[model samples]
Target: MMRPRRLPPCLAAAILTATAVAVLLLSASSPGGALLASRQSPPPPARPEWGPGRPPSFAYWISGTRNDSRRALRLLRAVYHPRNRYLLHLDAAADAAEREAMAEAVRGEPAWREFRNVDVVGEAYAVDRTGSSALAAALHGAAVLLKVGAHWDWLVTLSAADYPLVTQDDLLYAFSSVPRDLNFIDHTSDLGWKEHERFEKLIVDPSLYMDRNTEPFPGTGTRPMPDAFKIFTGSPWVILSRNFTEHCVYGLDNLPRKLLMYFANTAYSVEAYFQTLICNSSDFRNTTVNGDLRYFVWDDPPGLDPLVLNESHFQNMVNSSTAFARRFEEDAPVLKKIDDELLNGSSVQLVPGIWCSNLSKEQGRMDVESCLKWGDINTVRPGHSGEKLWRYISTISQTRGCS
Candidate 1:
């Protein structure tokens, strides 16, 4: 092809500068660009005044995948509290429309809108529950919560399949006396059969690279265990203190990053990453409480996932004294039972709490209208369930020592 005519040096410089300015303006107008600019701005405003003796707030990262939008919303409503922060994530399996719908639903809630405490992960990536991607997603959620919620004392990760056995009022009352630094994580140093099959075995998750979800496949060669830090594994579901979460996310020490790299190729790293990190770190080791504070019923020979909970499991779940439970079929009747007996409200309602009472009075609405009345959000009034939870936590804390 014939050579194109070249512009003069000064003219070309002017054209390039003009193009750069145009591109900058375009980016500054886009939503992603606006978000980037906002991050560079000052941190979110200081936390609202938590009155004396107020219960500590929790930052919840509720994640789900395809077809889990409604279920996740229900779970959010069940656990909703004006003081706590909520971050919802529907993974890559969920289409953009579903994610938007979730965001819209959250925005539609009067309390959620008024408090402005709930957020939806707008840009989501693939996550393989069986592989390191799950760990990555959890960390991402933690990081986001740390950024968005400056006042929350704890970080709790939940999936759509999980549901609360106790209301927010009951949970807050139960935890009101708890030390803010304690971590409720079910962990054990004993690897048992998992040492060979999980720790030593190598696997790669396709979801990390592929757009679609796929199971992780094992490699032919196995690797040796690490001597640097002992491996600890447990339930992936955990309630982590802000202090420990900050350690994992910010990595003041190299331990968290080092273990993260080591677990990238390991099977089900989500189960072990936080456990190992907390147990290995001197600052956080002593803070572990050795219980996830969640209840579940597993098969006689426990399978990969816990059994789906239903109406029959209601009594046992209630007696377990756990704040949360898992693996419930969507809209299971047991959830309704928990709502009626423990929550004192319907599933769609926002678990009546002190905040609910206050919000009702502020709006001049009837005291009984919509479960929102005026009471002190600072103080917690525990019920029989809260008493049970407190006793359970106290018993566990006394028996379990972090080594």
Candidate 2:
């Protein structure tokens, strides 16, 4: 008998890549898979309405480190809307129990359970937020969102320390008027001091190769900035257009992947990677809005991190007309105030919106509402806060072909 012909190496690799992407897109994440298997799975959610007539949906990537499960969950509740999709990732610092507990907590929520749009990443990995590891984690998240969330207009990334200043209704309503292809990222090509300190330095991120991430250290000498493409730096937080995120993850164009390799050894790569990538790509360059849509107050000359928000900042936070703010202590009194006043919610309840108003609507005896179904999920009822966000967004016009 003639020997069977072997498949070409390139063809085999392409097949494997296609298979992996399909698997990621089709399945619920690891722990969630187990949860689904343990009980009867909820029916797949109806496809969200897209286009100018309907409000845009978001894909949120919420990351936390160590014992931040509770805070991350709190953030999720504050930002929750049935219309949106969420992916939660707790780094290796968080124990497996914590990860499992978070997954369980998600399952406990009636709306989350009913809608089944939320998931916990089944695996654990270390990430130093200052290194290429963080950028990798972010790219990983965008890829997962692209695969799992069949359609969403934008990808919003937040940390455990970050909190929403406006409700999802407000967010969706504000974005409704904006172009679907626009990207909300703060970027400036004026590298200034960062040219030497961040871009020119050669650093090795242990997290890239090691099981647990260690501190990233610099080499003896620095290299010159690249002449191939200009570099832009800005806030690490961004609301990226789904189209741009697809470019980053799928590498349909080579620019995204090329920048990814160059930034792998640079410090605080997350701060510059997306900014650089978006500003460099001719296709996406004109789509920029030059703002992350988050509120933050740095120190006088600025420090490594933004100042921690407190009760003092509450009034200003409200007046800032921004959608989100950062660096809050876990369960701060300010948070409760935000819930009660701005969000029209409590710690126990999700921020009420078009999908569901009563997460715990129950009578004394047996007349309890089924959390599985609520009002029209396609519509939104925006409050005064929504108006402010829309106005703010309108002011930040599109980029003039990337500085």
- The top-ranked prediction according to TM-score is 2
Model 2 lDDT tens row, 119-144:
77756766888888888777777766
- Candidate 2 Cα errors over 4 Å, as ranges: 1-47, 359-373, 398-400
What TM-scores do the predictions have? 0.84, 0.88
Each model's lDDT comes to: 0.74, 0.78
Best by lDDT: 2
Lowest-scoring 10 consecutive residues by lDDT in candidate 2? 1-10
Model 1: how far is 65 from its true place, Å?
0.6
Residue 39 local lDDT, model 2: 44
After superposing all C-alphas onto the true structure, candidate 2 shows an RMSD in angstroms of 6.1
Model 1 RMSD in angstroms? 10.8
